[model samples]
Target: MCQRMQMPIITSRYWNMVHGTNPKEVQQDAEGMQVMQVLGNNMAFGLNCKNVAMKMGLSMPEEPEFTYTNFIH
Candidate 1:
């Protein structure tokens, strides 16, 4: 979906997920916490970069017109 929308997809060291039945259990998942942190940092960095680019008068690429296709008649 992100690709289709030409949006940046943030990622981490692993899948952005935490396995737990409760908040306490989730807190125990060290790896999951790390992944979340990494994702957050990445997103922040990306946004900062975009902001800087805009300040420099850089603009986003123009989006092409969309074409629809139907298989059913």
Candidate 2:
């Protein structure tokens, strides 16, 4: 969805998901925790870069009008 909207997508070392039936189980997933940390860092870095660019007068391109097509119709 973000890609369709031309929004930046942040990625990590693996699929952004954690397997758990509860909070405690999730906390025990070492690999998932690492992925989350990487994702957080990536997001922070991307935001910082965007902020610096804006400060320098750089901006994203204007979005074009979107057209929706109904397959059922």
Candidate 3:
């Protein structure tokens, strides 16, 4: 299954420098996500990001930044 990941602090609207990047997607919903380290507007990590988030016990709309609710698998 797909999911979300830890977005960089640069994602804040004030720091958005990615040419056409739009980091506003939740759950990698085939939507756009802001990429700072990389140029161009695209899904930088794609589903791989979801995997990482899962491994890290993360989910969409990362609240408390580094915290995740217990989701039963």
Candidate 4:
């Protein structure tokens, strides 16, 4: 009998969270990307946050827990 071998591909890495590290480490390298670059790259985050607050008839909390726990009547 013959058997077939298979390999798996992994896409995500935890090191992506750290900031400003080159080949030094995968985690630091990936995470180190600019902040505004990431945020500005994705417009939906801000709009989505605002929409959620508006739907609840709530305003941006001063403390900014951003939970939108305040329900609008």
Candidate 5:
């Protein structure tokens, strides 16, 4: 979806996954929480940047040329 929408994908120090069946157990997963926090922070940073750019009247980059091919044919 990010690729399709031309949005930058933010990555964290670790994959965002909490291996637990319950909320308490999931919360106990410290590493997962950290990763989620990182992801959230990155997203917030991105949004802030975009907002600043808009406020400064900065233009967005042009969309790249896209070509579709039917490989199955």
Candidate 6:
């Protein structure tokens, strides 16, 4: 769904999920923490790129136009 809208989806070496029943357990999940860090870095990079492009007057893609309709009554 995000791909369809041209949005940047941050990815990591593994799924961003931690299986823990308590805060301490979650804090010990190294992989999950790494995934979160990677996601944050990616988000920052993407935002920086957009900022630079805007400063350079690079054109951003136009938003898609659409109409919504009710299919079920």
Which residue ranges in model 1 land beyond 4 Å of their true spot?
Answer: 1-5
Which model scores highest in TM-score?
Answer: 1
TM-score of 5: 0.81
Instruction: List the lowest-lDDT window of 10 residues for candidate 5.
Output: 1-10
- The runs of at least 3 residues in candidate 6 whose Cα sits more than 4 Å from the true structure, single-residue gaps closed, are 1-6, 69-73
State how far residue 57 of model 2 sits from its true place (Å).
Answer: 0.5
Please rank every candidate by TM-score, starting with the best.
1, 2, 5, 6, 4, 3
Q: Report the CA-based lDDT of candidate 5 relative to the real structure.
A: 0.81
Candidate 4 global Cα RMSD: 20.2
Point out where model 3 deviates above 4 Å. 1-44, 62-73
Write the residue-wise lDDT of candidate 6 on 1-73 in tens digits: 1213366676766787876799899889988888888877887988898889879998677767667999999
| Tens digit per residue, CA lDDT, model 5, 1-73 | 1223376887778887777789999899998988899999998998898889879998677667878989996
* Residue-wise C-alpha lDDT for candidate 4, range 1-73, written one tens digit per residue: 2322233222232222444345556445434444434644454565676679779887543442335565777
RMSD after CA superposition, every candidate: 4.1, 4.0, 13.6, 20.2, 3.7, 4.8
Better of 4 and 6 by lDDT: 6
Q: Would you list the C-alpha lDDT of every candidate in the order shown?
A: 0.86, 0.87, 0.45, 0.47, 0.81, 0.77
Per-residue lDDT of 60 in model 4: 44
**lDDT digits (tens) for residues 20-70 of candidate 3:** 334443325332234333323333555566679769987577345356778
Residue 38 CA displacement from its true place in model 3, Å: 12
The pairs that clash in candidate 1 are none
Which 10 consecutive residues of model 3 have the lowest summed lDDT?
30-39
Q: Ranking under lDDT, best-scoring first?
A: 2, 1, 5, 6, 4, 3
